[model samples]
Target chain A: MYRLSGGAILWQHHPGLPAATFLAMPAEPAPAARPVAAARRRRLRADRARQLADLLRHQILAGGVPGGVLPLEDVIAADYRASRNTVRQALDLLRGERIVERQPGVGTVVVCEKYPHGLDRLQGLAETLREHGRVTNEVRTVGPVSAPGPVAHRLGLPEHADVLCVERLRRLDGLPLSLDLSYLPMDIGGELLGCDLENTDVFRLLEQLTGGPLGHAEITLEAVNADAHSAAVLQAPRGAAVLMLERLTRLPDGRPVDLEFIRFRGDRITMSGVLHRSL
Target chain B: MYRLSGGAILWQHHPGLPAATFLAMPAEPAPAARPVAAARRRRLRADRARQLADLLRHQILAGGVPGGVLPLEDVIAADYRASRNTVRQALDLLRGERIVERQPGVGTVVVCEKYPHGLDRLQGLAETLREHGRVTNEVRTVGPVSAPGPVAHRLGLPEHADVLCVERLRRLDGLPLSLDLSYLPMDIGGELLGCDLENTDVFRLLEQLTGGPLGHAEITLEAVNADAHSAAVLQAPRGAAVLMLERLTRLPDGRPVDLEFIRFRGDRITMSGVLHRSL
Candidate 1:
């Protein structure tokens, strides 16, 4: 984890080498998170380092630094009390997380988030948000339509079966977020179709209908453009950065049941996954 | 689909649909796609519906419009020689597969091809690009270091285990495209650490070492800012757009083996995925 300070290069050696480990330095007691002004009196160097990393990490997350601009060694060393080598080490740590990268001539830059999906996991979009904090979900449209194409193929729509399309706007802390449309088997979700979406989670709503999802969900990720309707609800420019997530769900009996399309604000979010290597 | 030719739109109605359901104009052969000017004439108007779709789809696939921006109604209508409503319908078809969305004030923008993950189907960074056309991988750094919390956690690495960190500069058609690093528990990947990296697919290499991957992966999505290194390697500004992908892999028997972080040029790629609803 990078300090929101200036990313001042936490110089602790990789722990547990037996002899070279920096000796813990007593954890510094987190220094009671002194205010910005206290540095002149106590622990000057440590305070300097902490503040530096904190400031830099905040800038990186806040979009203040723009994207891909690498802070120079001279700039960082001058801004903070640490040496150039210390700053270099911190930059390398960020590189380890794929948060930044070094280019032969371009120096270093911040890596933007990749808009992707965790298809193999059972986590839903909102669920993913709640983990970090409370993001917002705005329900815009909910209606029935004839399931078509792969969606039809996945839901087994009888070529003419009516499907419920739940359109909503997803946000992080009230910002313009993802806009998407979800389709449900009319015969199943038709009754719950009229339920209030504003105050409830769709998964919970689905549970009320099917007694609870069997638990396995298959997901796919893609890149697409924003259309007029989604554009209006997401409040993003018609063709801004938008990430699309599609998923298929099944009952315990292994029968596929629903289809959903989730669009995310490309500038604000990214995705990661775990892969299990075969023996 | 939205075409860049004077902001042209493409209309595609299922041939099997009833006459009234057609909701489109008669098919007219596309003018620009004529064999001689196939690439340049791609901007023409009077094209067959299928040809229009192909042209539009080609533009989307070839990264024609910046970030894949698609003009909502007017542009699409103009391209397909169809009504605004018909074009919207075609856009809807693409939305199902996460090909596009509508924004509140922005109209419609194309999603670049950067986000692609979250399904049983998984491939390495190298493999995905190869499918796009021609690409090359350049090894920049490949060495070992103590695992960090995230990578350590994902790879199930012990607190002190030495993990091999492999960093590379990926080029597509000779242009520097992305920067990536993969972490592997030394015990698991020690054998191949010294072999060819630029020309070898990690997955294939792993398979040759121990066995084939059992094919299981879990993904998470988040957003971050690009740093100095990222800016330099991606050849973007100090803080340009980027996409970071994190992944972990294990053996068939469930042994953690590989963890990777990939950073892509924000404006250079697009992403997409599919989803199923809850039963």
Candidate 2:
């Protein structure tokens, strides 16, 4: 339990200590003890703010915050029985994490949103997020080009082989979601040039063209700073972090057909899955 | 083919164009065509730099760059038939991505590393990266605490129930790697108080204490900005993005045992997995 009164704090229980321990502090120090006392006060305020921030963060992540809008500073301070400065510091901390933003007239609002993406299923964005909204693709560019060394190697082609490069800007609910850059071997890609890429996903197109179900995919996921072009396309701030998914998909016959580099807005998507103990 | 000569460029092939379309340019325009021609020249240089950056990025990711050190600016310019200014711009782009950095005495060097973490296996840090380096844990805090609301719900306990909280700073090769905060039910955690937590993994200890093999875990992964405390503990730059992994582990009998929130330095870890096409 924590109690704050007259600008002084009493921490009854701390995680670092065992059960049943109390530490009491002086209520008000003398005025002559100014500099050292002020420093101690600042440190104590920081500690209290951190504790408040942790509790609020856990609540926000668990969707327990009512209405997704934080109460005013005075209300928070009164509820937590802390000073206004402490509440402000806690909000600042959450703001730095981008978990909350202070709107001009709307008070502090939760800005964190993470749509679930399953890692155990090799599904297209549209198929996986069917319940979310309509996923539309704006095919920015699509044509044949000479494959670079790494692309050719991944697709099991010789150096400088022709491959179709498809660049699309994907959106959900009219908001930018991902920028997908896909490379396909010319044999299958040549046929896709005439398909309706603006309406359908490449996974469905490949299956329709090959007349067989896609088998599996090998994927690597990481967070990388978005480059200028990707940032502009995804509507993210320059140098902001983006979730980069590099996937190589193979056909049922075990031929690698499509290699994709997808950059998703980090704040909008969360990848999830279940893992068993294999060992 | 892309050819540059006398400050004029000839782009014969482009990904957005058909198979073999030639784009020939006037080698040298008159001096009076200065303003418009200069703007076009700048745009052309920017395009060339982007193309070069893509090729170099692919090479670096594939580990095909000899010695992991880039060639000199002049050498790259000459080899690609691009101007020195274009090479410098491309290097600047790479530097912005943090893929390559310039040292005081050394030339540009690759700085990207993604240690593989398998999503298909339920393993500890030490078990996952046995070949990379020895993983050591600095047990910063370990004791009993009243469980927060969300944690109690996850563990099937009443709110504010007594639970064990363990905070650790993990390292790889003596470099700060991850900061993990774990919560366990008091039944199992009481025994952990007397164990050697600094030298062993909690997963191994739980199995030994329970006399049963662990079952599975549900995980959610996303990129989050590092808070002040996590940044200081993990030795990462303040507000830099880190990979936040929230995991809930269950016993073979379907009882949720441990819940953890692990923050891994985004640049130091990569999560990889193979997924089947499950409908």
Candidate 3:
């Protein structure tokens, strides 16, 4: 009986024969052991593939494989003393995890890391940009006014009640990236009207003014075509794609305190989050 | 001093005055209590808005409000004995949750529920469609061949190893929805070549064949423009937007069992998920 172990076929009668000798033999095993032997061979091949995948995975992650491309199958097969098929299997594993992708004409290449948007906590665009570099705010308006219908409802205020509305353009490294419009209930945010909002983080200012940490928020993300106003503000062409994030932040007491409508240039932003089955 | 409560301004000295009567009076509270009284009033209004939002939420969920459009602001205010601003606030809350959306010239309308793609488990496209209605599969091909470089690597097989590839078009209510291409290791899937895949669920077939459940899957979702072949299979125009879901399912023994590349017509699908901070 010939047994397959880790991509190598071992002859029970000639156990020391190398893989080349086994391949040279007739490609047939005893009929009685065919089922069991075939199953074992499949498992062995799978194991070898997994081992190779792990080695390549480390190489890719460690930057050992610069340019994100693996060598030709024939080269890898010769180096590992394995068939081209085995090398292909290892490459497929990486593709499954999206560590690399294969382009028809260009061959397999590493995929750059995507931006991750942690959905666990409420994070604002200004904070996201500041993490990469310094962020500057261009305050367009900040004043107390009779809140609009939707704004009033969001802040738990009476329709048309007095509220503080702040409109600003956020820039990273002096380039405009997003347009933000925020509304705060005047009862708690009236003092914000007196602060230099352009220099202060709105979230921090809110925390200081409210004298407490902000709690959970409900956020909605959607894609929309850029309207004329948003296009001009984001410096994108009219009708260009944009990502809109609408957020309603609440106090620990479950009182909705602020509503924000923000538009990001889609080409410059990608939101990613890991979805879990259980919490 | 006068106090505002539930959208009604009440006079402490003239408690018997009707809400309409108080509205007709000069809009002024005692100067000594103005700041403190105003804060209290704001909180009270916020509470009212929250209460209204909760009520409307229940109504929306219960399908009490048909046609997805809520009653006009004036109507809700009069029915609830609240101001229009209070009603607006309630409406805005629903909007923030994406339960409703306001359309220009169309009034406030309920938004259609988005499809939630739970990243918690490995679910096949057929199962997802069956939940909505009957799903039918059209098998395009089922054969064995030398696995492509990427496919071989993913399956942990030798380069150009023998493998079984299945191509199918999935339909819902007789309308094409998505195109699915799956690659499986021939050692395990070779027998599948003889099965009628049009009537069988591939995942279930795999589980039965392997005598175990699929452990987990690493899935990636991205937007892509439909290519000629995919567009023709999905019955969508070339260059139309499509959602690509690539999944690599593994066996409980930590071996990758299958690789699926699925493309859904963008207009027919919207993937959504609630991201929590911790699991």
Candidate 4:
């Protein structure tokens, strides 16, 4: 029995092939078939550079370059014994995929990747940071304020009720990257006011306060440009492109619990999204 | 009663409030929620560009750039009174969400986005081209032959079936940008040889010959460097990046139909994939 690649190709044997071969013994090479593993050893350096690129990409994704700093040219080319051009090509491939990006004057930066935002995930900002192998936070702004129209609309709050507006800047390896703004009802957040923002994440704080963890979440992806304020904090240029993610989380009983705004640098991210349908 | 953007925020309400206030309030003097749209000047500019960008993007997706050339920059910037930078930002936004690009030396080239090569939406190669805009095909080879493993699996034919393989180069506005190799069952496609490839899409021919049309398809996206032979035909450099799409098309009733191989210039085309809940 002939076997083919899963979900891609099928292989089936013909019972009448021998009989057919006897009748059609005189034919030229068939068209459109990929040549079976031919040998003509003029070139192809075993593609060691390509393999190294693969290794590096996997490492980056697996948090090998945990600090998000990657050497640009020297180490990779040296390790693979490939020309800088070849190494650069591999890096270019990654850059095209937005897996890594050059920071102009600085070295290449690894903008960590996250699971494609979805309802199935209700991870906290701290959990996402820890998953990427780095963590730091600075609460830029937090205060009790009268609910705004939109926020009040989402929270189903009386226009006069105060909501806690917590603006936290998240960092990786001491460098600020994302500006996360969260809104929590005063009822749920009243006890957490004295906590240090630089050292804590809201999700963990909420679980500690409520005695239960968060569950499903709904998130949306949008494209945005950084204004001067965001660019200065994120260390990117003003008007630098960004991917904006807005997420609202719910507990197991469908109670809305958290609302988060995640603004990711556009340069160094490669997010994977998958769709599987039920038959 | 209130409305939040269609995600998890719809249900949650601010405690102690029945409805949002200031729904009819005049624009506030200060920025409140969503810093991105906080400023009147910036928000107006951003919104105009976004709407215009969406308009142009639809045109591009509809294959309105048939000459494979258009003054994307001038038309956008002048018409919108947006700076070249702003217009470029809009283009880049579309570039990421859509598959189209501009090379330094080459004018803006329109690369028709290809359908996925997955098992669900196995569109015939020519039909995929037609969706891009007006197209013409020039057949290079058409005959029965052995099928590649990927093709074999997709067709669901016996591994040893004498597959009908058709190879053709396709063009838009006289510029050859893509080449295709399609495989079908030999008995089912003997009629394909009689049709004129230069004039019509092969799927239309298949519908006439086989009494049905393809329904759903699934596609996989990958990158491949064009070989010397492929580079010569596509007029692109060997080792230059090319977008490769491998697909399997199935009949409306779920029987396997056709498998396709498509190679496109990486710079000219971008790809769009969606991840959603399974139905």
lDDT-best of 1 and 2: 2
* Tens digits of per-residue lDDT for model 4, B33-89: 444433544533443344345445545644666676657687656543346766776
Top candidate on TM-score is 2
lDDT of 1 by residue, A1-279 (tens): 122132122222333444223211111223454444454323333322322343354346545565558668887665433456546666664564355678888887887443333443566666656655554555544544444333456677654455565556666556766755566776665665456565466776776778865556666444444444454556755444355555566666766656666667665566654444331
Error of 3 at B167 (Å): 5.0
| RMSD per model, one decimal | 14.3, 7.3, 14.4, 13.6
After superposition, which runs of candidate 4 have C-alpha atoms over 4 Å from their true positions?
A: A1-120, A131-134, A267-275, B1-279
Model 3 residue B33 distance off true place after TM-score fit, in angstroms: 33
Write the residue-wise lDDT of candidate 4 on A1-279 in tens digits.
121121111222233554233111011222334443332111111222233344455556646675788865877555434457657766765664456788888778886453322222345545645655566776544545455434455566764456665656677666665777666676775555656556777777777787876665555444444544566667866655455555666665766666666666654332332222222
Pairs that collide, model 2: none
Q: Write the per-residue lDDT of candidate 2 for residues B1-279, one digit (tens) a residue.
A: 222222223222345754334211112222353455566655545555655675576577766778889989998765544568778988888887677999878899998755777777898887788888888877755656656566778888876676776767788888888877787887887788767777688998899999988999999887766767667768877656678788899999889889888888877787888888864
Cα displacement (Å) at residue A121, model 3: 5.6
Residue by residue across A124-163, what tens digits does model 3's lDDT show? Answer: 5555445566666776545454554555666788766665
lDDT of each: 0.52, 0.72, 0.58, 0.52
DockQ of every predicted complex? 0.12, 0.30, 0.06, 0.05
> Order the candidates by lDDT, highest first — what do you get?
2, 3, 1, 4
Clash count of each predicted structure: 117, 0, 23, 30
Tell me which of candidates 1 and 3 scores higher on DockQ: 1
Better of 1 and 3 by TM-score: 1
lDDT of 2 by residue, A1-279 (tens): 222222322222345654323211112222343455566665545555655675577668767778989988987766544568768988998887678999999999999765677787999988777888888887755656656566788899985677777767788877788877787997898788768777788999999999978999999887766667667768877766678788899998789999988878877788888888764
The reply for model 3, stretches above 4 Å from the true place, is A1-114, A119-122, A125-266, A276-279, B1-65, B68-132, B135-266, B277-279
Model 1, first chain, TM-score of: 0.57
